[model samples]
Target: MCNTFPAVSQVDTGASQHRIESAAALGTLVSSTASYLTVLLSSPAHASASESLSRHHAQVLWDLADIDARTAGLLARILQPFLSIGILLMIIRIVLSWYPQIPGDKLPWSVVVKPTEPVLGPTRRVIQPVGGVDISPIIWVALLSFINEILLGPQGILNLLQRKIDIS
Candidate 1:
């Protein structure tokens, strides 16, 4: 007698694939939402000093002296990644500039010395580089990170967003 076994492969399990696709879509949505919000929050016109103050006033009166928790959470989620990426980019730029050797003339305007009238005789004391010491990049990285983490991190954005939403 010949006995035939049932094929287990014929059983369809489409739910797993659907779940994975749903998860991926959700991730994309969250990332995009965060990015859009970050751009809005960081915009010069939107986050201006005057605008921020107005927003703070609205939040105090309208939101019952409290900010919306959901908005705050979203801002935190978006800003953390953005600030981290900015730090990473700054680090990369610093590293890249170290090897190519940027020209002294091409140095940022802030670091460049301005020409001034000579006080003694017909000569001026031109600023000269005495040695090879470029600490600006290090200082920049430290300052940027400090600003992002301390000043512009969770508290700042949340307060700003609260003010904005409250005003509008």
Candidate 2:
């Protein structure tokens, strides 16, 4: 029993000594790395190089921003006209709906009906015809108009972006 107790204490002491040595080595390594970093950061040449890199980085960011603004503005200009045309076409479709005599299969009537039907068909499924009249065209008109007003309107996204770009 006495021999067993001394063996256990020896093992415990050895393990504790190993742990302390490992902790001291780790601390020394960490402090050395921290001092190296501190020295590199404090050097005047390193500071100037970092400053120059920062200036270049800022210029690159500004250039990228300018390019993005130009591209977005161009897309906005193209999309605004497309939205307006969509509103115009939807309005024409609504007016044509009033005339029952116009044969839908014929060339002139087909032109309007063909383009508008794809959009109206899905809309009809969601919003059924009311009192024997397909109100899909009206719905599309209101939707298109609303979209046009929201996206390309006076205080719209494109306009706001253009203004911001211009001001900057």
Best by TM-score: 2
After TM-score superposition, what is the CA distance of residue 43 in candidate 1 from its true location, in Å? Answer: 28
* Regions of model 1 farther than 4 Å from truth: 1-65, 101-136, 151-168
Q: What is the C-alpha lDDT of each candidate?
A: 0.42, 0.59
Tens-place lDDT per residue, model 1, 1-168, is: 101101111111242111112333334434544454455567766437556445534432332223354545555676777667656655655554465554434545213211111211122123222355344444555766886766355566455644555333
Least lDDT summed over 10 consecutive residues: which range in candidate 1?
A: 1-10
The TM-score between candidate 1 and the true structure equals: 0.33
Instruction: State the lDDT at 83 in candidate 2.
Output: 75
Q: Scored by Cα lDDT, where does model 1 land? A: 0.42
Error of 2 at 114 (Å): 1.2
Scored by lDDT, the top model is 2
Off by over 4 Å in 2: 1-67, 166-168
